[model samples]
Target chain A: MVLTERAREHARALVRGLKAARIEVVASVPDQWIGLILEEVAKEGSFRSVPVAREEEGIGVCFGAVLGGKGAAMLMQNAGLLSSGTGLVTLHLLHQVPLLLLVSYRGTPGDPLFYHIPKGVRTEPALRALGIPYFLTDAGKDLTAQVCRTWTYARESAGPAALLLTADLFAGEDVYP
Target chain B: MRTSRVAYMQVLADLVVDELVVCGLGASARYWKALRPRPENFYLADSMGQAIPVGLGVALAQPARRVVVLEGDGAVLMNAGCLSTVASTGATNLIVVIFNNDVYEASGGQPLPAAPVDYAGLARASGLALATNLEGADAFRSALQKALKEPGPAFLCLRTAYLPDEPIPAYDMRPLETRLIFMQSLGVSI
Candidate 1:
């Protein structure tokens, strides 16, 4: 599927934000909305991109990266986040390792697919339950700044923080039809 | 005859100096902590099946230092997919040592349903070139030395026997404290 200009721009902004935050390593389990972002990350020279088999494995990777004194982020979808609760709690939260999570907010109101609704409904509550602070991306807001801020907060707090990418940030009219 | 887990750990403790160690949860952590009480040794208190993934991350971030992971058979079975993930990274600085006791020794010696998994074959099939299975402490030590010197993401499975009566010192440090000390040792400011 061809990515819309809007999606491309958003992907670029996300990569730029990761650069601004000095994220040296990224562990990703791909999602449809974040594929372009992953592509951008792979193309970026300064970042080490690790493609993991599972979401929880990505969490462990980020945790180890941070422990090695590198800025790291996990890129995945909300469903992956739901599946990663154990690692997030046992490795990141229990040890207080700073991790920046860039997650696609799938199954939301803007999403046309009915199957995504189940994961969308539980994303925020799951985040809250896990004690992970998160920020939702607004269509009008600057994504780069939002990512940078989230990274900073995770570093300063020495805990995990998430930035959820809403559908409006990447999808155009073509995404619906 | 199966080798003693403690003996293999002692071999590791004696051989490791500058390499970073990531120990799996339960007995692996306890035994490693008791043997190698240092900041470079990151003892996992609760996270089972994540030692290899964490070590892979450390190896990727710090390419100069060797990152060794001490994983149990049960933990490896739980997260066997990590072997593929680690191999895909093509990290030459990581080494995985699985202590295969044929049971979850830490969780009350429950026998693993799939006992005696050929982990070395699994690793080789997963793309790790330097993978071997050893049955004795001397063999493990030799393999570990070779794995450390070679340029590879190596995997070593040591067939070990469980000693329920062996006294392993209790790990008193909290998980947060463990993380801080480990970061400090690595000189990681963040």
Candidate 2:
């Protein structure tokens, strides 16, 4: 997967936002679109990155971090968001722990992969059903500010909030084969 | 003779001090809440199979404080993959103690498939710094004492008896309140 200059910059901005929000721990499950951001997080060194085996496990980790009084986020693809419903409800929602969810909004309009379409379509509805507030990214907008705001909303609400990264944000026109 | 779950927990309550404790859902959590209802103890009343992962997070966040997790056989088997993740982190402050009663004591006394699985072996193979399976009250007390004193990401599996009619007091704290009080106890304001 080739990452475009714009995508790299967006990744950097997202990492900057996380740092600005003082998110100390990030639990992630990789997606092609979010790989650059995860890489940036590693290079940035401001957050502790935990690569989890499953998406639900990431939820548990983030919940624990929040309980310990540190800011936390979960990075994964929209499919992972779909798979993590039970944990989201039982742990974060039931317990009212604040967690920022950074998800690659795959299978959307510009996405080339047909398999991702289902997840893209169901993402918003899933979040709604889970009662998690979300924000969608736009290439024209400042991603750092968007991320910071989403984090703030999560913290203030004392519940999970999601920031969905669109293909445009990642400049994915020719990145995928 | 199989050791009673309460006996093992009694030993733990007597030994544990300032360490943060994460208890898994079901009877184990209910028992812990009754035995030591302290803010330092974070009881997961409903989320099954998540205690270890949460404990790992707490351990990572507070490296200075030891995090001991109380897990049940059924719950651990449900999320056994977390053991590998915990091992990978190599967080020396985390300790997982699995009470293997060979049944889902919380839901009912449903026998976990009759396979004689070695939980300690699984944890060892997963690369934990220390792993041991113990039986009897004497063995668990000594092992737990050693685990507290040692530097390790440890896993201890204790063979316990199934209590069909264990009297577990109702956990009255709401989920949000529990989260807040526990955070307050940890001196974290957010």
Candidate 3:
């Protein structure tokens, strides 16, 4: 019922699913607003966390992980997706590396941060063009179920999949999954 | 005018027998077409500057096997951080060679950062043990021999001219057939 309790449950469920699916590496650039679940999941012994210098590097790192026979995930912000341009289409698209980009969306339509508007508006189109399937999570409870389901799709498709979690999802609502 | 793809493959194939050869994506992977496990095992498509980083992880994880990375000029320009990481970590058994094509051959004939960027200098300044720039197969073979002879992170910058498009075999190494043969060679139980 409480926010913290929901976060704890969702975080555990997400990690459990990642573990069930055999995810071994969590490569990420520190993004505060999204993928708080990953921040918690990373602490477990099975999931090796490799802090990356850039989001593109995270994408590449996950690709390398897959090649090495390990499941991998990446954490970044919505704007960070823009930074992931080269790695996304180049490696994930060309080489067929299965990757998941867990992103935090900063600006939605009519939301704050005017600078984010341009990128926010174009985000969906960009993912489609790259053939990267994306979903949105505006509720904290949706994090685990959506993230796990996306992983299934990513592994099936073997390209990058995404969860563009809204900041309000983590900040606003009181419910947890 | 000087060499064939097989020549490069013969030399590199022997070098990478017990090693992890990270192939930079696009046609650069073609040089490694015949190597055991196929090029895709070591291939990172369009992942410029990714081979070295992945090679570092491989070298660190495997410890016993020497690691070789075949990269491109554009790939190097994209992520020079791999050099810095290799320098700081003191990860030996890693060798990076850039097949400097001077252009992004995969997308379009766009100029690469190679003209403006000095890859050898970048490696040296990153505190690499050895960094050499060379042309031709003989020069490359010599560099390849030396890099394999030693056991510290090093880099070679090879200036290769344009390679015209050819129909490369649809190379994919993740199939069960390939994985079985490759893993058994590594003494891995799959």
Candidate 4:
């Protein structure tokens, strides 16, 4: 199914914002909430799209992209955050590789998906525990500025940062199963 | 038909020409660092199963340059999903050389499963352009030559002997220092 107009605009803004931040590579695993955003990212000619099999692999890809002198962003859902904990600690955190994680905040309040709830509850805690800073954005928030700031903070700190996209951000779109 | 892990790494190191080399944790990193202690070579100290994806990224970002990943069998098993990703992305300039000793040499000399996997087959199944299982120095040399000359996301599974004999010095450099040098070598302004 095609994305709604609001969802499409949000995705486009994210893609454009990342490009403005000089993000040359976008490595991602598909999530229902961010699927259209990932597609928009792929269509951006300036950014090289890399679709990985898993979240940890995307983290590794982003690590290498930064090492090669290009900025990188990883897009995934909250469950992917748990899958990427090892890579987050050992690679990005340890080596001070700056990675922008554009995570879909699944299982947040008002979301009906029960399986994703636990991960959503733990997402903020996990980010805090790892000492990685994050900014949670809802539909009402200014996402363009938040995304750019997240990129800046990650690059400046030489660590991973997360832009948690709330469920409401994909409002009017059929993202849930 | 077995090959020394150190010898194999040394041979491949000689073959590399200004390519970004990423070494997985454990013996792979140790041997590569010992052979070629250069700014371009990233010896990942702790992240297991990350070497290939990192190399794939470098290959993607810098399409003109070659990127090599020297990974251990156990480490690759930790993130074997990367194999399919590498194939799917179709980065032709990337080469993955697995030092398949079939043992966890870093933690202890524990034997892996007796029924060894067909890694070359796995790579081929995963959609790499070229995949081969090589034993002895000649076969490996030949495969490396072919892979270098050809356009491919290639995979080479090298049968190595599990040698815990040579206790190398611990890696002294910090991760930040290595990162700086590597980016500088890549001509990427930090």
Q: Best DockQ goes to which candidate?
A: 1
Which stretches of model 1 miss by more than 4 angstroms?
Answer: none
Give the DockQ-based CAPRI class for model 2.
medium
State the weakest 10-residue window (summed lDDT) of model 2 chain A. A168-177
Interface RMSD, all candidates in order, equals 0.8, 0.9, 4.1, 1.1
Candidate 3 lDDT over B1-190, as tens digits, reads 6344445556676665456677776666644754445523465544567777666655554557777888878878888866766676576778887877677766665886535677899889878858887777777888888888887788888777665564444456543443334334445421
Please write out the lDDT profile of model 4 over residues A108-136, one tens digit for every residue. Answer: 77465788789888999998988989998
DockQ of each: 0.82, 0.78, 0.17, 0.76
Name the runs in model 2 displaced over 4 angstroms.
Answer: A175-177
- In the predicted model 3, the residue pairs found to clash are A141-A177, B48-B75, B49-B75
Residue A71 of candidate 4: its Cα lDDT? 91
Better candidate number, 3 or 4, judged by TM-score: 4
After superposition on all C-alphas, the RMSD of every candidate to the true structure, in Å, is: 1.3, 1.4, 5.5, 2.1
Itemize residue pairs with steric clashes in candidate 4.
none
Write down the DockQ of candidate 2.
Answer: 0.78
DockQ of 3: 0.17
Clash list (residue pairs), candidate 1: none
Ten contiguous residues minimizing lDDT sum, candidate 4 chain B: B163-172
Greater DockQ among 1 and 3 belongs to 1
TM-score of 2: 0.97
Clashing pairs in 2: none
Ordered list by lDDT, greatest first: 2, 1, 4, 3
